[model samples]
Target: MSDRRSEESSGDEPSSSSISDEVWEQFLQDTERDIRKSAPKEPSARAREVTERLKGRKGEPEGWRTGPAWQEMNGRAARRRRAWAVIGVPLAIAVAVVAMRPSLIPGDPFGSTAGTDTATTPLPAETATPTAAPSAAAPGTPTLARPFAGSPALRWADGAAGIVLPKATALGAIPKDRVELALQQTRKLLVDANLNPDVVAGGRPRAALSVLDPKQPDVLDNLETSLRSPSKTHDPLFLFSRFDPKDVKQAGKVVKVRGRITFAKGKFGGVAVHADYTFVYPVVRAGGSTEVTRTIVRRVIDAELPDPTRYQVTPGRLTLLRYDEDAGNSACDIHDGYLHPQFPSQAPTGSAAPSGPSIDPYDRSRDIGKQEACGTVSRT
Candidate 1:
């Protein structure tokens, strides 16, 4: 589950009940800035999600054009914040469907040359084919919405904004079916527990840690560093610091999260299954001054199911093998989510802190991240 899964859409139609192109493209640019600014030298995890999603589909979208550079990028960021404040997923989009197209990048979605005329003024030869109408959804490829039952308890958490859980459907014992079930369940765990924003928001992470059968100590350690450090300007973004520590005692609440998960497995590993994930969550900035939300995050994560013989269903558990916070669109970001696909090769954007192995998204300004929100204390 790379950001592409969350960034790009499979079909040409605007599954989101035809959300206008302007609104969607603006969001693309705004989120990209969030990624770029998080770690200037490295690509933003969210940008990678946009890039990877468009990698397959290819090119600018039909009738969509980039706006002027003068317009502030955060203008779209503001609109996005408002959009997330509304619902878990749009009426037409499901857990896995995040739309992606070349026209998404402000002036150049694919980093290609820009066209001068409006949609009706078409005459450009070089970009014609690539920007043609979207291809039809391949025939017979069934698309269904996986149901999710949100954790009722989360509703009571103060400062809690909203959450996007994995899409799930009932499954049977068939080997083929088990793999899909495992993948869906794995995603649920990844978004809710493993990528639990509550940890950074100053809430307990037991919900996430509880699901790891063969726990990875790095998970908790990294989270502690991300939560503890204290830098005011470049406040910690959960997307960048999987568990990267920061300095703080007060912070913001997780307002919204955008997540995607894909299942995978095969012969070499004795029929095991695993999942890849991309998450984008927004935080209402810390501090008591003015209650404004500024951080918008996009992250990558990988989870593997334990040996089949020991697998359980009621509460699916998996080994926390890899959690690469802000792991941009590297070829290595995606884990096998489909049958027999090879795992992508992933490397750290930069060296991890030796004294503290997981601190990430180093900000040159030394403005790394924020502390947990009001009314919560460190569990470390």
Candidate 2:
């Protein structure tokens, strides 16, 4: 009786080996159509998560720009998930059928075929957007206790300590010893020009000037002339970072500094040391107001030490090859001997009309370009 029942069951249903490829494909299509008609039309859970994320993004502070890569990825992922919910049915059914009845499809069961891999490819890895640390105050609003609160300089090294020097290496004809001396002198010159409290407070940068060769024709004379009488073409503040003492007073002893110093073979002779740095100074009204404002100065100077054997040069002094600067929060086109930092309460001058694009003083990714007229700043 058991043998008879087995024979009847075998006759009632066709064996897996007997099904043809065309029949198997038709079966998958039929099953997919039935499943599609039954599947819910509502968005999947992942779709709701994406929508919530977008809604939350709208609440972020104004002017806080984040990279678009992460958002773009989220959008792509949401779209892919929605697509798979519909099209994945047929693919999944096809795979299961091939597993249960491998001979029905012929050849390798999982062989590469057109449109077969539409669901298997993985999504690209995502990256999180970088964010600045929290601050006590928003940008453009400065307080004495949190002078650097909203500025990038808040994270920068304080004072001359930020002027880090690299290991001195021999360059061309110059030995390591001379290269080291050049590095040290260059750092001292930078400190004197920008970080010295006396120099910053409208006083002459005697120490900085002493670093240069006095015998160099026009170099010392030009600097002296600029200090004596400043004009648009000749401003002492171009080399020395100074502000009018009568207008503002230092809020604290800290001066935020960040940049790099590099040395290479001199274009003219010995070793050339290039210093590119930005200094952030917090100052208040000379009358001693508690409200604080910051002035940002970026200076790029190229100084060289000539080979003593080849030419006449000053000992322990550098030859000024190039000097360039850009001052932020300072009134434009005002060529006094000082950097005129504009206060929040001060009225805008005629030169305050920006003639060019807005610049972010904290952005050191590129060199500051030439300014023919007044330019606007994106931030303090």
* Residue 116 local lDDT, model 1: 32
What tens digits encode model 2's per-residue C-alpha lDDT throughout 200-242? 8988888888888764556677678879998655567667878
By summed lDDT, which 10 consecutive residues of candidate 1 come out lowest?
77-86
Writing each residue's lDDT as its tens digit, candidate 1 over 1-380 gives 11111233344553655567798667756655443332211122222111010001124322122210111222111100000011112211322123334332234322243343122221221111122211211111111110011111111112212232333333233355455555654545545543456454445555554555433323444434434552221122332323222312112333223323444452212123333222322221123322211122333444554334322211345444333333211111112110010111212232221111121221111111121111100000
C-alpha lDDT score of every prediction, in listed order:
0.28, 0.59
Query: Which stretches in model 1 have alpha-carbon errors above 4 Å?
Result: 1-177, 193-197, 215-254, 267-287, 291-293, 310-316, 327-380
Candidate 2 residue-wise lDDT at 7: 9
Per-model TM-score versus the true fold: 0.33, 0.63
How far residue 143's Cα lies from its native spot in candidate 2, in Å, is: 0.7
**Residue pair clashes in candidate 2:** none
